[model samples]
Target: MEIDQPYGTPERDVMCVMVCGKLVDIDLHGRRYDGLVGLIRAGGTDMSEAMVAASAAWEYARYDSDQTMPGFRAAACQQGRGL
Candidate 1:
């Protein structure tokens, strides 16, 4: 599973899920923070689970990259601070 931004447009966020090296699902949210709404609109029944999975996948991908953006990392880290 991976998050992909459209080529030449970093604003569009899309999540791609692969199973056995084959593409299974693709979730697209107009903005990164709109993931839950997007998933719901796409027929997801478990919003909380979807959000958690997306967040974990994003964090894992971000930390695995050497050229990660500090702002993105900070924003993601701050999301559940009060919870």
Candidate 2:
């Protein structure tokens, strides 16, 4: 999902959150993508926890949350690489 950036493309920086030596989450906030980047950047100890928080937003939030979004519940998160 990489794309040309306004300021020019930068090398992708792949960051991950490891839980017990396993990658539980990943962050590509500075990369050339959308959606999950904002969630990750919202701030957390790691991407995995951030992702969980973001996903849970749908349930815990009153409105304008991922849960309220039409398709967020079924949205596919990339939980790969032993996460």
Candidate 3:
């Protein structure tokens, strides 16, 4: 996965599915969201479907992720800071 620092929010990172990798704009159906709240709103009636969609988007982004990018860190790295 990758860390996506949103424009004008250096202190915060958007970890949503569609923003999982570098080429996030291609992830699918979530660029309109702001965060969990937005996603929940997008869910309207069924939150599960929204979650499934988010996961799919994450998987899609991860599938073509370029590990060399500065924000592209392995899931394993999230387990250990290594510092």
Tens-place lDDT per residue, model 3, 1-83, is 22363232321132343234333222233442453212223223222233333322132233333333223234324544221
> Can you tell me which runs of candidate 1 are displaced by over 4 Å?
2-63, 81-83
Best by TM-score: 1
Which lDDT value does model 1 have at 60?
39
TM-score of each: 0.21, 0.19, 0.16
Model 1 lDDT, residue 14, Cα: 27
C-alpha positional error of residue 28 in candidate 3 after TM-score superposition, expressed in Å = 30
Candidate 1, 1-83: lDDT as tens digits: 22354231211222223123343343544555544323322243233233333343333344234344344445556775211
**What overall lDDT goes with each candidate model?**
0.35, 0.33, 0.30
Taking all chains together, the TM-score of candidate 1 against the true structure is 0.21
In candidate 2 the C-alpha lDDT for residue 6 amounts to 31
lDDT of 2 by residue, 5-70 (tens): 431222122232223345333444453324443333323354433334334322224423444343
Lowest-sum lDDT 10-residue window in model 2: 7-16
Among the numbered candidates, top lDDT falls to 1
Clashing pairs in 2: 58-67
Name the better of 2 and 3 by lDDT: 2
